[model samples]
Target: MAWELATSCTNQRVVGSSQIQNEAMQIGRKEIKLNTTSRAYVDPDRINELKTISSESFDLSKLIRLCEELNICFAGECYLSMVMLTRAILDHVPPIFGSSSFQQVANNYSGAKSFKEAMQNLENSSRKISDYYLHSQIRKSESLPNVTQIDFSNNVDFLLSEVIRLLKK
Candidate 1:
């Protein structure tokens, strides 16, 4: 499904641009149009659910417990799930790429000779990732709202502004 969508869209980068365009054209006489409204058509109920989950307060100990229960490494899906769990407990923690603090938590847990050490380590990692997500990505994205606007000029600022905007949300 994803491959079809990628191949059927002009905006997507699917290998060589010319080859993709050619293939898309060959598939049909009409050119494939990009579906740029996916993000705009967000469901209000889902948004509300996200808000409810994202605004909850996270407990470090709870994460450790869940990790133990799941018996999963905090590297791939486990890390992403942990991030979601954290977001459910903390609204300010944006779901930015690489924003998950699972590594820090894992590190602390491993280094801990006592409960306090583990707690402190988790707290430190969580704080760091949270600060990076909220201040850097969120702030930059908000500071520029016209990111979706594309330009063919040397004005890189315009492109960056849009990139920042997407990151913020």
Candidate 2:
């Protein structure tokens, strides 16, 4: 039955740049176009896990807990999940420049202006990595590279300590 439906589509053609074709699948009286655009490696379950304890301002203990979760994700080879969590962790530390933007968070932070600038640099760098993981459909047909050990170790450590320091002042 499935093969009949597949071969019945005579109008199927490779359109646009994507190798995937937007062909219509007919089921009874309903004909729906299949979404050929592949998605990135985002795991909904991991997203839910990250969202559970997410907050605008995390204390020392909560930061530790989040780090543990991140470590688990890294070990499990869930790189996209880990990157999303990394961005969340960065954004969770509050006191941004009257906004929640990553640049704002990095810019108007509680630490020294120079230190904040450094954080912004890190934020910008990580954002690229996140975007790469985000529009992952580009790599849908290709062999994906292996996810390395997430380096949030130092970045998270530094950000948490700095936030703690800022809170003290």
Candidate 3:
């Protein structure tokens, strides 16, 4: 038997074997274009590198998603979202390093000296920046963060590289 589904002049044909036909009929096609004038703060190649790590014992879904969203927010110039997402990634990945907090990860993780330093920068600077944005209230005078104020890509890349190393082991 065959079935057909139709909506708004679009039709899908289903076969008896539960297969969907590749070709569908459309009465009219509407095209919508979006603005493409955006830039990425975190290099997309770094994000792609994180996507390559997979481990049976560890679930990196949330961590990877946070990195993806952080890049998107940065590209959109949403510095607040970028900062919050950066902090969230730090908070969420501690357990992967066998630590309860990013501070502990910075202070205790048995890695290279430079790696620990990067983590410390993230734990201190990024956390403090995000805290200010998360906890502050509206006032008569307010200052918005520019790219320079929220640029933490190098530290984040270092952290992600460490994560990949740990997971691959």
Q: lDDT for every model?
A: 0.30, 0.47, 0.67
The residue-by-residue lDDT of candidate 3 on 132-162, one tens digit each, is 9999999999998876777787788788877
CA lDDT, candidate 1, residue 139: 44
- Model 2: per-residue Cα lDDT over 1-169, one tens digit each: 3233333332343111111122221223222222211111222233333334434554344444455445444334456666777777676655423456667777666657767766776688777777677776764476432443334444555565555444443
- Error (Å) of candidate 1 at residue 33 is 40
In order of appearance, the predictions have TM-scores of 0.22, 0.51, 0.74
Candidate 3, clashing residue pairs?
A: none
- Quote the lDDT for 148 in model 1: 26
Regarding lDDT, does 1 or 2 come out ahead? 2
Q: Residue-pair clashes per candidate, as listed?
A: 5, 0, 0
Give candidate 2 regions above 4 Å deviation.
1-64, 96-99, 138-140, 143-150
Count of clashes in candidate 3: 0
Using lDDT as the measure, the top candidate is 3
Say which candidate scores most in TM-score. Answer: 3
Give the lowest summed-lDDT range of ten residues in model 1. Answer: 145-154
Q: Which ten residues in a row have the lowest lDDT in candidate 3?
A: 14-23
Residue lDDT tens for model 1, 27-128: 443321223211111122222223233312342333222222111211111233333333333222223212354344334333225533433443454445
Report each candidate's C-alpha RMSD, comma-separated, in the order given. Answer: 18.5, 16.0, 11.4
